[model samples]
Target: MSSPSPKSPELSDHSKKYDRQIRLWGEHGQKSLERANICLINATAVGCEVIKNLILPGIGSFTIIDGNIVTEEDLGTNFYVEKEAIGASKSECCMRLLQELNPDVNGDYLDESIDSLLETRSEFFQSFDVVIASNIKEATLKNLSNLLWDYNIPLVYCRSLGFVGSIRLQFREHCVVEPHPDNKPLDLRIENPFTTLKEHLAVSEVNGKSPWVHVIHKHLVEWKKDHEGNPPKTYKEKNQFKEMIRIAMKSDEENHEEAIKAVNTVFESAGKISSNLSAIFNDEACQKLNTKDKNLQFWVIAKSMQDFIKTENNDLLPLQGVVPDMTADTDSYIKLQSIYRQKAMQDAENVYQRCLNTLLNIGMKNEIISENTVRLYCREASGLRFIRGTKIQSEYSDWDKSTTLAEGLECQQPLMELYAVLRAYDHFYTEFGYIPGESYVEPDTPKLKGLVTKLLQDWNIRHPVSDDMVYEICHYGGAEIHSISAFIGASAAQEVIKLLTQQYVPIDNTFLYSGITTETATYKF
Candidate 1:
């Protein structure tokens, strides 16, 4: 069959189907989503829910690893497994049902245990983009976490137990060029306009029809003349600057109003290097860009940007090529937009060349970092983020000595108490052959309390887990409620999407959700 052209109607329809999300993350992010291959460790209720959310968004494919068979309990808690699927392989049943959500998504399942896969065919996991594990034992989870951490693949470990759920993201390092932060101001560079922008503004007239950029530039030029060639630097001066704009308004012009509103932010540290970006540039990874590892692409680009800032760019980050909408004539708006767009393209091209030069010097392929990727990185350079994550196994091994946990408990946070109880539950399950509340809630309450007490003592924490909290957990009996599972499933899937697309910032390390109070918290351990 012949391939569809770029203007094909079929491609348009495909884009239209995901138009809403495409608007959020752009076409490149959508392509990343469609190219991802997710590995789900178990087909439990929460696990299937995570898969459902990812599949609906048209992920490339998924592989479910499970050795259990579907049972009556699964039908009650899990939405993917139907009643007729009883006695069938749980992973296979889930794969068949979930594939029905999006035919574009491919899926398969191994009716084998994850432990067996880890021991016998561990390399099979190398192909996946992200791994989601649910309802896994601590011992097995540690092995898997260690393995994936060594491989530098992100692992979304989550559990939905009764009314509470938690997710811990484990990875070696992750970098984001686009964090999609809200209320990012337009980088107009009015304070320090480039040659083209200065030429455009020099000829532009300030009137009711003028764009806000011109209006602000005109008033700013006048303000600088009267204030010793300086913009407003103090709070009172800024307010006075706004007053100047308000008093100079010939009428109730929208552009003038926008100028007054923009006075506070437009001149506030324009063309300054943010502390976060400065930190990124100074990071060891960015400093040591001579390595041959392809994973250092973000740092390599960052190093190139640093060099650009130091040499060619006059110590300023790349210009973000975007402008705000305001009341203006079509010609005026187009002219202003063109000036900024051209400057941005020039900056991006400069950065892209530096990246190519660095890659060649480091003995890597120049094509490893494409022009489009560099453009995207330069466009979102101000909002770039880098996260270095610790393994889940380390969290477990050092749980008792965690000062973050200690401080949360000292503050009498309910979620902290829940965290302790969950740890105790894990200890109970490992020591005994069953979950604490699996068969009997009343008899196991004391045992769970004892385990929590021992943990606190070992950690030397003075805060105590109350009896009521223990009873509450015992009452849950380790049962998986669909509502809680659904909530956690959606949250986990969102984090997975962030990881796959490398767009928005994922949680720093851990996220805890409590259905009882309808509140959530993020913790970095």
Candidate 2:
């Protein structure tokens, strides 16, 4: 008798709970999220909203740091605290409510002000994977930014006041393995096939009835014969090449039609390095591999890739091991896909060996990087990203030398104007111990405008902040609108997830949202 068929494994509780999100980021990314320890400063509406989203996604744990007691105003803006919770610790209230969202997520609170924490237990901040600061004062923000920069911890500084909000991401350097870009083209290697791929294509039966990839390969080979062994490089040449495929169509087959459609993009992108990937390869970090620092695993793998390209791979990134769907029989498609997969596996193995050799050359333990991790890096080599962040202190200290701000003012961009007003609002709060319009909008308009003028002058910007914008800022009176907080908070949470999982691309540095215009913009400092 045949052995009993093995039953398919069932989903674990953790996987079942986060099934939807696991689908989004995959189990690897979900595990990263589940292992993350997030630290949030302040339990303001925006801050709670940020944690609320994170809690639902099953982040391992979170610590809320806020010394303030909840007030009636807090009740209006924050949904996490109730009337009974008034006069209680804001951090505790937020933690209690947020923890209820996901039992799998562990949470705690520190009823201490940020300034106090920085003074006494600054090292405490270093323990977290990421820190989210909301509605913090400018001086406090600079201090926290500097502290975290030294610790090399990523900080998401966000604020939601009135109808405008902004988020600034501060990190020394961040590397992303899987950007999960949309509609990424297949890596067919048609233009520059490897030995295995070329061998397969040479032997595969080629006809209109076969897969489009095989058809394209057959035609590309013939096209290369008459064109000095080079695939069509010019626009006119490509078009001529497409016409050649069109003429070879037999009885208007769908595979031939698909082949014709792919002619434009297939050769253009095949065997070419994207500018973004090229930039990553040329980055200073990748150029200078510091073997002493065990944490520089991304750069280590990147250096291995560089070496692999030079020595074994012939100056090309590893095959992505993917093929796009095309008109073809199941058997033909599977056979072609297996060839690509086999080549991809071999390339990954080569790079993995190189990584191991690099690690040993530096007298480091090979266990510092796992073989599985190296394979992941090789799979995502083409989409690798590295971000070098600027400190918030630098942006404030070097306002005069900022050409991006100057250009934005000259162009009269609405978001840039809003950014100016927000800076002036911070100044007003610092000088007067309250926001401009907290008491009365009409009385604070000129005062706020004066601060805006001073800020513009400091930056050497000749542009003026419109009176209408100043009035709008004062009318909001530093009040945190719940809806706006939720919007910005959700957005910030998304950025935080990107940082934690290192999957999707996070914003370069700054994200600005205007509730009035219902628009958002990102800028690099």
Candidate 3:
């Protein structure tokens, strides 16, 4: 489509509300982001930080589920729950504050524990587009994971313990149509332009005031005719082609330099697939994606595109749906741009229809693939990219992943020893009524230190944690640090957007970050 006119009356309120983000990802991605209904299981600092980010971006709706009453400790951790809300419901306090960030975004609150909600109103979890669970118990998280897995919904598990944070992403096999790869290959279809584009260029004659683009197009047709429809294949032939364009220039003409400059583009034969595209087409995932698959949007677009190419019998990829700048007159440039854009838009529509048919054949419906989705897919046809995250089953069963995860132990940056201490703390919290250490009360440092060692041994981690580090973490009693929560919350929110919009690569399976030293690591099972 042509550039949106600044004064156009067709722009929607959504476009105004999300103007900046719409520029980052296209209107389609913004729409996807706006359509999401996110759920946060806890109203802690990390959770509120994530929700704050999403609320400002105008997500469709969000539900905060927390049954605990706000306490003095909670006030110190979460910014939204002020001292005035000390005895109020955690979910209600956070919901009120987060909703004020953006009135356009809808908000809901369930003043009940996630375990009770899962037991009584289990269907409540299925309606959300994605779920974010933070600071949940191990058994509760496992139950939530299994439920979300059954429903095929994505879940981002986040945790922030004082100075360190970690994240784990779980979803069914996912695909990304537009991972927004850098270094997009040149998409010039000069070798074999589409019918409308070819016809437009065939009769589009060059005048004295015509741009250098017309000069190149005129010689391109002549060279093809002379060489039996073959472009210059080798370096020698390319230079010979350039010399031909140079010889055609008028010596006395003031614009002879423009015609001579057309030589640089005359030999650019680059409309075919790149090595990445070749690999994508031959991917085992692409080969095996069929009726019983997850019905991801990317795979649907890709399979429909395969059908589109097969029917056309043309090996060229779909148009990138772009028009580069040229030295043409205003009218000439618009006309030239329209020719390519119209073909690309038409090709996208064709792909959309084929996608409907593919869905129908697989016992699905047209609603499975939106028109905007297919349109963006075709616009990025040459730039089609996909990423598959590690399965939760694999993350649970993979024993070899310990070596990779253990790399965090090598860095003394902040000491990953807290990971084990937290697990032990959780064990203590479950068995006892309170956490390892409490404020204004003497800390049980000796008992907690012993629990930390036992927990470390249970996990097969050989890292030797110092007595002081364990004491400090326990002494702090896992109170939320605003700086750590701010950074990790923003990071998790970014990943959630990527997953919802399928615009960029999300966290693989695990991410370990230390704000103390700004050290980060990403791992896969």
lDDT per model vs. reference = 0.87, 0.85, 0.74
Q: Give me the overall lDDT of model 1.
A: 0.87
In model 2, where is the ten-residue run with the lowest total lDDT?
1-10
Runs in model 2 lying further than 4 Å from the true structure: 1-10, 292-295
True lDDT of residue 213, candidate 2: 79
lDDT of 1 by residue, 1-525 (tens): 111224634558788889888888889889999999999999999999999999998999999999999999887899999998899899999999999999999999999999999999999999999999998888899999999987778999989999999998998888877888776756788877888999999998888888999988988899899999888889999899899888889866988888888887887656677777888988877888747454678888888888988998778778887887777877788788788888999999999999989888888888778888888888888878887888899877866446887899989888888888888888888888788788888899999999999988888787898898898888888789999999999999999999988888999888888899998999887
TM-scores, each model vs. reference: 0.96, 0.95, 0.78
Better of 1 and 3 by TM-score: 1
Better of 2 and 3 by lDDT: 2
* Residues 77-174 of candidate 2: C-alpha lDDT, one tens digit per residue: 89999899889898998899889998999999999999999999899987899999998888898899899988889999989988899999998888
Which candidate gets the maximum lDDT versus the true structure?
1
Residue pairs in collision within model 2 = none
lDDT of 3 at 251: 58
Q: How far off is residue 110 in model 1, in Å?
A: 0.6
For model 3 the TM-score comes to: 0.78
lDDT accuracy of residue 457 in candidate 2: 83
